[model samples]
Target: MSEDVLVVHGGTPLRGEIQVRGAKNLVSKAMVAAVLGETASTLYDVPAIRDVEIVTGLLEAHGVKVSTGPEGELVMDPANVTRAAVDEINVHAGSSRIPILFCGPLLHRLGHAFIPDLGGCKIGDRPIDFHIQALREFGAVVDKRPDGLHLSAPNGLRGIKYELEYPSVGSTEQVLLTAVLADGVTELRNAAVEPEIVDLICVLQKMGAIIKVHTDRVIEIQGVAKLSGYSHRPIPDRIEAASWGAAALATHGEIFVRGAKQADMMTFLNVYRSVGGAFSVDDSPIGGGIRFWHPGGELQPVALETDVHPGLMTDWQQPLVVALTQARGLSIVHETVYERRFGYTTELRQMGANIQLYSECLGGTPCRWGRRNFLHSAVIAGPSKLHAADLQIPDLRAGFSHLIAALAAEGTSRVYGVDRYISRGYEDFDGKLAALGARTERP
Candidate 1:
């Protein structure tokens, strides 16, 4: 586990049970929500991913006391909230983009906030212009500095009616975190309505915030005078569940992912079934999860598109592509979410999968990247015999896809930089791989 290189013996179908905790996307935001509260907040079923660690560090630097309780519960006391030094914040945040989220809460708590140079997965250019404009609209003075961004609310934050050009989740989150404490009513048009955003609204409600979700991607938030803390359990990690399901398909194995709720994965489940994979949902009182397997038949190729929530997730596309490589015919994937998401296909092709990337939109409606010349479309022609090859970990989801390909391939494969990228999202991935009977060694 100490070594960065993982030597994986291939052609073994992974079979076993692995447990998932809270949604990595939601839990971190909930932790950030704690900063807006005057009292302490408690979050349950939190994951052990590096993003959580980064958020915890950022909170602690701002004088929030974060402590762990029994069974993955986190207790965060914002009683002594204070601004942290820029260098210290930069050092602790590493490459995570979570620190940018602190701008809203910190502006309310201490009238000023500083964000270091932000970094995240290299999938695409995730510009923070939307966030800056949203904050500016709320009456915060934003100044760009050499190191990072400095934001100050001299006249205090006042809510304003705003509309997003595109329904970006990060922009929605910024508005939510800021609007909860601003003056007057904040109306956001074309807001992101993802389940995680809904769950975050639930968290805000528990803190005495008044928010309303209207139809047609409109959300209205009425600002309040003061807020208290909240105690809540976060939603389960749907992305992790889908990743495990894809692993089962690629390796021709069976995996029972405990804590994978079917309600959160309906879209992914539909796609998994359409690909000729077999799965059954179990909702017993003694903990429930989904079991996925290959079903010992020719896998069906599919024409897929990545979109916002309620559509196929961009994060789920990569691992499914690995499984699609084993399908009997041609498979098409149109990535409408992130333009550079198909970059991982090159590594998959190196492992003997017939994957071709193109700039033109394929198999779905034209999107933002349609005429941008980004290689966002992929055509994977398969039942291509996979062979092990040395692979470098790219981003989080793509890294997991490479891991699945290595496990499904013949001979041994060496995976490097996993500890840096994959560990950012997946919790104890090596331990889970071992539990699932993957023959792996750190060297």
Candidate 2:
């Protein structure tokens, strides 16, 4: 509640070092993976974010005892996993999409699961059809009630060869979690091979799940009868790292992001360099991180499209767009991952950005959204001197981008709903901003 509003005095460069812990994308799923284990599991570098708190509460609702082990450690003991009361489940999971992931692990431990209506960032049509269909294929009976979704595995779970229509991260995680404990072998094609997903697979493997990854988009999992605990240190938050990188570029400052991995961010790094942002990768064991800065020149503009793994991630698009606003020429951005991801551009435009959205695919490749009449492509003509305006935080990533835009703008900006939206992913962002010398205060 204290983070509900922030008043940011703009037109200042952000300079300093910030550390990003475990990824927001992987940490929650790793905690949920603990539910599939019989004994206790330990996850290191768990971020102090709202999403982790939500998952901790949800796990507690289902009787998984969650506690801190050491510094930055989350210990989850599923020794007493059981079915939680409906109200209890709803209370912990009402505002998160994490509950949908609880389905697979819950069905394996208990016979059933009661999932409350899920909510997350309203980025686009994030459908659960792939999840539901995968569950049904694995022998779970799904009942859609007015209260929420009720799922039961009457015949027990059995593996199936499933192919994803699209390589969705959530859907792939759902399948992996379910298939790990099913009766037989499960082959998933066109799976999302994001670093977070791979890290999740590593967690499951440590817990005795047999998983094989192919060069192509195929993942084969051999379901086991039982699984024990695991100890894992999740991958660094690449999304958060890229965000800070964009922040540095947009504000014409330098930032050293500790724990940012270069291998995980090769695509983003290439694009960052293309935008005329300078970076140095330091992989030394003691002082390892990527240093990002605007190397005292006009920011370059280039065409970019968001795609699956090994492509420009959709999550990386928003913050980078803020940096693109200062580019010397036209920057074309085609968002193919989510149809409604450009929703935040309207807010950016209000802050004096010259961004225009189009329905056609403006990049090199034509995407699914090309003919769907979705305003998924953007043309930003920059070197546009930005001036601040009152803005509302739209979603998790967009909220951070809004802050970046505010820092780059001329006047003061009143960014509202930070507590409600931004805190869901970012951990102690105000503290990080203060460390970087950006002037902000709660209003």
Candidate 3:
């Protein structure tokens, strides 16, 4: 098997157990958080994903000592942390948005930081304006140039009260990373309260940082003078677990996702059950995970709206849409999070799925993209016969969705660009697929 393209033989249900490690979202951020520590920090359950490799390169460029310990463990030493050149940083940050997150930690450690051109998934207009604005609020000077953005704390960072127009997770993380070592108190209004955010707070607290989470999406951080290292086990990737579960449902198979936590998947579980998927949780001493399966009946259609935490996740919507294609009736998916996420559905349609994109909101929710004329909503007419095709992966989550469609299709499928995008999040994807009885090989 080569490393670029996956030739998947379809019409087989994926049945087996696959282990999931730390979340791609939290693990990268945690690695970044290690920069704020004065000593060394050890993170357990780290996944071997592209994002982690990118962050490790960026951190090492800044003189942080990153080494591997036991399996699924990363030890990061930031005691020798120093500023890295813009070109040096840019070369290592290829197609990753993680460089934008290094701003606050760099400013605190070296009083200045330079961010190269940021790149990430082409799912939406993910601007750095929010990050820059928050940095300015914390008294950091930002100079925009053609090369990149230069930031410096001329008078040192000072905490200030700030509120976001929307509860953006990246912006909120920027605030936390900066405010933890600021001069005074920082209060954030309309903050993102995702479980990953909470886990970050836990990591910060372990490093002697004081933070408070209040009701109604409020977070207060009291600035501290110094911080130690942290030893933490990050939360598992719920998105990957749910994606595998959706794959099982789409192909009419059963899968046991070890290390999947039930508490973190409540919203997805509810939606999965509503779509006629059955899941059982195991809390025994032997192993703990969720078992998901299709119950050999007509899958029900569901009306789903993607929102922030405690709501339907935008990441989960893509893989679930593949399962929705096998349902009996029409399924409505309102993607309120990212406007351009529906672009991947076009590829699914090529595989014989009946999906229609709409500019108007269709799930009866008043969303921010309602009148924006973006294809933010989709109506999927299900039970469409899916067939094999040469598929191109667009982004990470969408790439996984395409893989699910390929596995559930009728013939052989040639899926390209899996290594480029899907490896950014999913670890050992082809190996895991092969373990789950998938007939796939690299072409």
Candidate 4:
């Protein structure tokens, strides 16, 4: 049996309760932030995902002593943070996009950094132009190399005013990690205020950085001469939480997601309600969770769009789209965030989903992808009866969506490359599926 493949006996509703810890999006970046600190930093409730492992390995490569606590607690010491060992080595052979984020902090501390080509989920064209420009604005010298990117702060990093064409979360993170220790103040406009980004800012603040979030998506960071480590518990995984919520809907099951927060999931909650999926929030300090269920009725479809933050998140779009296949009427999804997000819809169509992709923007909001000749929008006509088939997992979000489709479809589905993609984000996913009574096995 190969670990890359999975056998999913579909028609099993994912029931029972599963707990999510700190967000995958946050925990990995927070680990990178520890390299920016002078002393050791402690983070609690970290998930055991492959991304975290990659980040831990990258940190160790830079001489950061990372240790674990009883649970998912990690303590990182950057006292011996070193210049990257090899100028040409690609960390994790480029399995992560996070390596690009290290350019800022590494330049600030070691005066230079060598980042190999970065790799992440192939959802769309996520370029690093804004990130490079922002770094250049901070007075860092960048040289493009065959192996990867080489960055050096010959004149040292300084604060600068920068604006993004889009509210890109990665660029915002690059700026935050660099600006916090630069000279003078940094004002960023049209920034990404995603909950994960805000939480990352808080982590930096705990490490003795001063940051202010003002009106109109503006974030100001006052550069400090020095910063110590921080002790923090990151926000729970909202993306994963929403995935389960959508899973419950797709399979007509009920699932209680522990550590799911209400405040962070307002937009998703509203959409869940709009789709006729029922959810109740329990905001207890301990053992709190969101109970999501099908509520024994036909799932309603609605027009949906993906945006940066405070909008329907792009990550949640795929899984929920699976649920929408079972909904009454048609569902319009305008993917404003990623130009090629509808790629997974093809697999869904193969599973008997009545979906059509469009190059035109399906909604009133014309996104950057419109008129770019990309089929970024989708119209799903349902409730379509889905049957299992041989499937291949593409990227992370789409992989999870494929898994959800397989779980919700009739008969069984053979899904390949689950170990590579799904484990990168979802921790203990197979175990969790088993606990949820899903018959998933490695074949």
Candidate 5:
């Protein structure tokens, strides 16, 4: 099935309520936190993805008893966890950045651990250097092995103040997980405070971890001898909700993203409105939802830039850029996050969109992706008639953007890699398409 390409029929209006499952970002961290607890942690609405399976298998390898009920409820008991075998290490090799997080809990619980090489969205060289550095601050000695990473803390862990160079999500999570059971308070500065991280912190707090968040990008974690189990309802996936909203705009359809939080999506919502899109949001006390639609007016092209949380998410840039194809004028987008993200535009060009890559910053803070293969820029000339063909998904977000483009195209599109990982976040995608009046079938 990995080799099979998903064929999509274009020019279908996707309408329906797609219920997002537990976030891919949250579920993995929640799994890791379960190990920190003394009792069983049962998580509901967990998304069934390869990463989830990898984490689950890793937990089971450590002698943690994990089982799932019929409705995808996951029960994890970590009382018996001792050591993770090499066979378990093989399960998550090249799977996700998450396996590296087990280092903290494994070291605390068993005093020795081995973490396989990490894998995730291949945006760039996401080395675990920051994660290693942070863990070392907490009194861990790590050795790089040919097969995997071997870590030990025979003297036990004593927390210290640590700062991150870049707010790498995996590294930040490693700090949080490792700090929970350390000897003293650990302060993390310049942390990646993405909503997912906050959600993970909430889960830890629920488990009796003493953690405090200050406005100056500082998180203080006081070490505790033990943590009790927690049952948490994770925050909705903002990225997935943004993709659905972008799909509505690109396809010229209306969609109400149920369970979407407007608080986390303010930047995206602002950008969408700037593009002559109209959306009415229903804000809840805790987690709000949004209803997005393309306004029946002249679509305006606006300059776009990607940033961390609170700024434009780099992940949403691809799909939202597809909607620019229907706008009347040229749209400028600065991708400050990932360098290779612009590669998807070449694929869009094959389908008749006028886009040019620029080498210079085009006038902004040139991002990490700048200076490498026409980074820091893309000029999209829109209102082009999209003709579908064979499309391939290079990564997760790009895959969904490709799916949106295929859906808005004039003919049919054979999108390879839909089976690769699309189901990880999108639930009942085919059925949702069916509800949206799209003529699509699994070939």
Candidate 6:
């Protein structure tokens, strides 16, 4: 695919409803789960993202019959999984972090697997150490080859107790996939408790897997001899919802986000309200959703921080920073989860935001990663003028932030790399922009 660009005319109030599709996180995992079943599994409401395509390519390489349904749904049959070719792995290796999720099912069915390097956000050094170690705990012998990682479970997987030092989503997903088919029960402590994990667990349970979630960040999985194909809709993308909410706040506009769940966005909604953003939820609407708006009031600046699940997500930091730029006073943002998250703020700086990076937190809250010599703090002195300029999107949330910058800017702005992968999560983002009255067109 060639690089695509977005030309956006600025200073327009976004006013309309945008429907969010299936969660990108869930659909990818559902594709991974399809690898375990012999029959065809159909996944509906799947977004056409590059990462999703990459995962589908990986599945096809592993000898699965993958096809698109008439309704834009995804169909997968893993009956001939033994036809997995190592050379075909190159096409999808290093495409996404999701490909590594195949380790568990592949090991269970074939007893050996080869995983290429993983690719995703570049916010920090997202090492797969936790994943490798967790797989080892499940009796998988892992070896780092010059090409990629080689894994084998000669004796078959046996349940073992493993505790993670940090609750990483990818690491937690690796453990869950590997543990489900072990010979005995496997217990994972300090597991990531994100909504995506919850969805994955539910999908696994639908396939006859025995899994239980506890309040203490623990997950117990009982080894199942086999799992059937599943068909389910994944959770709505909360991160995407937060991005649209940030766009509404930054432009001081009103927008209704359909399919945005209140339960999934509790942390972001609370922060939105704290920042003087107004929102209302329709519990019994035709389908149920929420509307977020600025309501022509003074936006409040907040001292915020990012954390793992149940905390301010690091992915939301970049887009929310755009809203913080429109706040009345100083807004201090501490990015504790990813050290390099503040890199996108540099782009926002060029758009006329008064944001300064700091090596330490001004507040007394000592962050575990911040104290270790990372430039983990940002101070936004806002109510500043933003001007449109040529911008390039480096990542997902940063892409949304640039979009907000374009909307808040005074003139036309050109954004490159937009078509690279933005639709993976946004789902007809350009159409949403048009509905909102933003002069958005592709070039």
> Every model's Cα RMSD, please?
1.1, 1.0, 1.1, 1.1, 2.0, 1.7
* Alpha-carbon lDDT of model 5: 0.82
Per-prediction TM-score, please? 0.99, 0.99, 0.99, 0.98, 0.95, 0.96
Deviation (Å) of 409 in candidate 3: 0.2
Clashes of 3: 0
State each model's CA lDDT, in order: 0.93, 0.93, 0.93, 0.91, 0.82, 0.84
> Which pairs of residues have clashing backbones in candidate 6?
none
Residue pairs in clash, model 2: none
lDDT for model 4 comes to 0.91
Colliding residue pairs in candidate 4? none
Q: Taking the tens digit of each residue's C-alpha lDDT, what string does model 4 give over 122-223?
A: 888899888899999999898887876789999999999999899999999999999999999999999999999999999999989999999899999999
Inter-residue clash pairs, candidate 5: 15-436, 325-383
Model 6 ranges with Cα > 4 A deviation:
1-3, 70-72, 362-364
Q: For candidate 5, write residues 1-443 as lDDT tens digits.
A: 63457677888777665656678888888998999899999888786766688788888888989988875689999999888677767777876777888889888888988877777777766778888887887888988878887999979999889888776677789999999999999999888888889999999999999999988678999999999888877877788888989888888888877788878888988999999888998776533478888778778898888887777988889888899888999999887766667777777888888888886665457666555664658888878889998887777787888889899999989888876667656666667777777777777
Expressed as tens digits, the lDDT of each residue in 103-129 for candidate 6 is 888999889888877777677888877
Candidate 1 residue lDDT tens string, 264-354: 8899999999999999999984578999999998999999999898888889999999999999999999999898988888889999999
Winner on lDDT (3 vs 4): 3
Candidate 2 runs further than 4 Å off: 1-3
Q: How many clashes show up per model?
A: 0, 0, 0, 0, 2, 0
Residue 436 local lDDT, model 5 = 72
